[model samples]
Target: MVRVDRGLATTIGGAGVARVGYSGRILEAAADDPASGPCVGDWALVARWTDDRSTLEHLLPRRSCVTRAQSGGTSHAQALAANVTLAAVVVGLDQTPAITKIERLVALAWESGAQPLVLLTKADLAADAAEIAADVLTSAPGAEVMCCSCVDATGLSEVRDRLGDGTMALLGSSGAGKSSLVNALVGADVLATKEIRADGRGRHTSVRRELVVLPGGGCMIDTPGLRGVGLSGGEGIAATFADVDALAAQCRFNDCSHESEPGCAVLAAVEEGTLAVRRLESWRKLQREAAWVARRTDARLRAAELRVWKQRTKGSRGHPKRR
Candidate 1:
């Protein structure tokens, strides 16, 4: 599936892109777990009844998926994309990069099981593009960092080279130049783009997550700017902060929280000027969030189990079996 909207999915196959809806069984499965539903970049089995109508019969196992804690404070995870090989965290250099947000997004990309790439867009606008990129590299450990300017075409070839014959998904906040990056990669004005305001705020140009096959092979998904994305787990966080994790391994206590704990290697690094205080704080913040989400999900699962038990008990009592 290249794109999913409402109850329909647009899939690309040998027959070309076709609009499809879910079969009854698939709809029930989706109702029970929205994450199981087809998402952009997913592969599916489709049954075509006619040229105008088709049904999504089954979803193939996804090799990778990008998910986030759904917005509006729900513990449910919203699947962003599936089967993505490369996840690019796009951030514009027009304004001061939100290092904290970058850390969060890097975690999201890491959790997706795809290699993360931090693409700094609008690099031409920032004279200290390299310096800013260096700082971002520290925030996003285990991820490649690149500074590109679609305007002057600087670094476009490098970007294309990095995306050789694999699906890459662009993840970023609004006005982060996701659409522009897609146009540059596609080598044409295939997607609509809007200019960022003087204040650096960007309007939504790509309203939906859509996939396009690149000219040189491979595919790319252009997504709307994500203002804020919640982390669903800490696996990505640990990967993003591997340096901090390495320090934590040397801590005196096995369960050192790294707060005010004595002999905490993480804090010691901060004092020794090895680790940035901001980066540590960012790790702590995301850790708390991931823990909270885990607790909420566990509770929800327990409640569901209890409901099933109650229903079974009621049925047994209401319908007595005869010997």
Candidate 2:
């Protein structure tokens, strides 16, 4: 599947096919022969081309993936997307973005095996860019926070120069100026913008996950505004708050939950003020979601294993049971 980078699909489907439009999402193979290899995931991107021309080719192996349990209470991990290099979460100065949201995205991005970058939008609207950016940095913990006023050419140029030639995804709540930043970085106003609400909440702009190529060189994947970001699995959570994770390892219990445990270094760090209480809470929240999802995924995996064992046993018995 092509990455969401808006670049034209690079064709490699053999002699008969022509690659056209490309997106990183890989739609599950509706029909397949299992004998050939392992099954691909169900939710894959539709790499489109001139009618009947586009086809799913080589699957870009995911270096890391963002997943959550299906809401239907099934033991399944539905992947949000894959093969991302950077998780670029945008925030606007016009009462739009929050440090907590950026933190949440940073945790998710860290789990996805991608670096996190916090893009501060509408810098011109802010009276104090440093104060706001500093807050974002505190939440993101060593993430790159660049401020840009889409109305200006210089700030936009710096953003483009840095984001150029990489695979980065833009994520933020609505009215965060994600779309505007994308247009500015691409060196063209290709994306549409809308006014934020009087209350400073985001109004929806992007509707789906689409990738666009920046004129400066990198691929930018823009997604629809998220309704919520609850994570599952100890994944990126552990990575994002690595200091906490490392400290937790010093705890007495091998599987320490780091909650009220004796010899809990995590708690000690909290007591000593080495870690922020809010960050710990964010980590715990994500860890809980991930653990719940993992249990569901494990159940599904076990059931699949049982089914396979039963099939093999039945087939062997039918073949005049081995002596």
Candidate with maximal lDDT: 1
Instruction: Quote model 2's TM-score.
Output: 0.75
Best by TM-score: 1
Q: Please identify model 1 stretches exceeding 4 Å from their true place.
A: 50-52, 317-323
What TM-score does candidate 1 get on C-alpha atoms?
Answer: 0.95
User: CA lDDT, every prediction?
Assistant: 0.89, 0.65
User: How do the residues 208-247 of candidate 1 rate in per-residue lDDT, one tens digit apiece?
Assistant: 9999888969888988888668888889999999999999
TM-score per candidate, chains pooled: 0.95, 0.75
Residue-level lDDT tens digits of model 2 in 147-201: 8897765377777677658677777778788887778777677777788788777
lDDT of 1 at 133: 89
RMSD (CA, angstroms), candidate 2: 6.2
